[model samples]
Target: MNRTMVTAVNTLGQLHKQVDLIGHNLANAETAGYKSREASFADLMAQQINNYSSAGSEVGRQSPLGIRQSPGARISQTAMLSKQGSLKTTGRPLDIAFTKENQYLKVRVQEDGTSQIRFTRNGELDIVNAGDQWVLATKDGHLVLDENDQVITFSGKVEEVKMIQPGTLEATMDNGQNIAFRLGVIALNKPQYLEQMGNTLLGLPDGADNNINQIYSDLNGARRQEISLQQGVLEASNVDIGKEMTDLMASQRSIQFQSRSITLADQMMGLVNGIR
Candidate 1:
């Protein structure tokens, strides 16, 4: 295949990936705490046309240039947007809104009937049935843990969970952030390292060695305060619908234009072949 065709193919692939990301963002526009991701690309290396200057004895070399085709472009990265999502009020005590500065909540979830912990910024929590017991779960339905390091499962309609005050929640900076309540708090060495387990909850990645006991810490050294939870509110996705729509249009047009260029190139080559 021609070098131009190769470049065109890669460009089209990039466009397709970009469109998919935009569609995903739009689909989750109403999702609580959904963070949109953007695709990034880099230019492929092309052959140097001439050696006008050189450090050695190759100054002003006039030899025929050799073709050095690029390996082709690809989606280099998919960076997650860390911008604060909008806050919405739900008037339900279990609903929580994470502030911009110190966003993220820690929770444990069941993996193959076993439990693991992870952190997320989304604060949507609810109750669900598990093994004949109603358990307090994250909005996505992961079990919530109590002071005893046991999954806090409730049965049937139970009283609302005790609302902890902002003042009561404490933060200790370390390998993982340590969050404290009067009764108990879990210490996370690297909250960001926790893997996403869907439904606004996260779990430890495989091969991780996270212990429940590490979450508690009595040594109150240089630590900041933890984010306090409000009873009746949930955080909405931070995605700007208008901006996303605009980006989507731009990506669509780019793909169309690039595709047309490829078609034109093919037609030009076909015409040349017929002339001989």
Candidate 2:
């Protein structure tokens, strides 16, 4: 009976985490460029006990001559879904949306007093003043980088900026000087290796410096693959609230069922103790 209770308790714990993950998805349903995560469950180890030594005596047995006691179930792994979201036209020139789901924009970030490179799916752009010059950046204020790994900077009031090609920007400066910049974008063949840095920022793993080139490919200039991009547009969050709600209800039911099993185990224990 105690073992039964333990198994139910373990399953309940895993169910709780699954519920929390569902809640997170629902909360981010309106967040721009947010991706949903999914969890998979697996059964724990089981102990098999043989009940009969002579199989010839139980020739008509309908089931196996053994009892299997399983520890419980657990969340095996969680995977991020990288499907492209719906495109929303914002009518703002800086707003950009990547039709390719695997593409990410390169941004310069300051973390722990150290400058580092990060990647993001968020396309909301802003121009911020950095001392003597103004640089293009994300809405979060992370400086956007060009193909040369440098921040896109300009002086004086920005006259106009347009997307001449996929991931390429053309800006007309105040002095009527037209300059073209190819935005730095990387195609992550396997985004599962990326380390989440919060606020939609992702980075390479702790020691993946050597394998970055092998796993990710730069999409710029001649190496640039055909991409569908649109300026003055944004990508909405890919989360589906209806599916998330259904998953939430299912997880809640699992929790309730596990609790009932624990209750039944306790009642069984009481009945056995009362045997005279």
Candidate 3:
């Protein structure tokens, strides 16, 4: 195939990937605690041409300009934006929002008969009875954890629950007992390393050496207290609808231009073949 066609094909492929990413951001615009991702493009390796004249070579010296032919462009990385989203108040005691960045709540999930810890920014929680124990859990039934990495559970029925402070919860049990527990607000050292597990939950990537216990320990040892929680509110998605729409239009135009370039290259090849 011609070099123009090859470059156009590669460019089109990258554009397609970018468009897909933009679409994904738009689709999750209203999702709670959803972080938007931006696709980064980089030029491919370029063919370098040496300039003998510029190098002061004695033989066959020509123009001093150095020429380079870039192969095309590609999506190099998809970085998640860490910008904080606006908080919406729901007036529900179980709903919570982080006032600081890079903080998340820890939850325990059971998958395939094994329980694993995951993190999330979505704090819309509910109370459920699990084997005669009342536990604070997410809507999907994952048990929320406390500061000690243990599931937040009550022995008896929870009559009333209130947020005494940002991270402290006071619960009144049916058996005339009141208990106070600190909510687990973990500050991630590197939030970008978290992989999206569906429903706004994030988990460590497969084969990652870091676990929930290790991360919690690190946060405690480092004395990192940059994060604070807000009760009765939830964080909205960071996606900007207008920006995503503009990017979609730009990517569509680029794709169309590359498609035209490929068609023109094919037509030029046909003309060359017809020449006597």
Q: Best candidate per TM-score, number? A: 2
User: For model 3, how does the per-residue alpha-carbon lDDT over 1-276 read when each residue is reduced to its tens digit?
Assistant: 798998999999999999988988988898888889999999999887865444454456464466788879999888878789999999988888887777888889997899988888888888898887888998778889987889998888988888875577899989889999876777776666777776577788886764645443333323435447888889999999999999999999999999999999999999999999
Tens-digit lDDT track for model 1 on 6-118?
78788888889988888888888888877677778877765665544445665575765443556467777766676777778888766766665334555676668876665
TM-score of each: 0.71, 0.90, 0.85
Residues 88-162, model 2: lDDT tens digits: 999999999888887888999999999999998899998778889989999889999988889899886678999
| Candidate 3, pairs of clashing residues | none
The 0-to-1 C-alpha lDDT of every candidate, in the order given, reads 0.62, 0.86, 0.82
Clashes of each: 8, 0, 0
lDDT of 1 at 146: 50
**Decoy 1 TM-score against native:** 0.71
Q: What RMSD does each model have against the real structure? A: 7.8, 2.5, 3.7
Which of the predicted structures, 1 or 3, would earn the higher TM-score when compared with the native?
3
Whole-structure CA lDDT of model 3: 0.82
Ranking by TM-score: 2, 3, 1
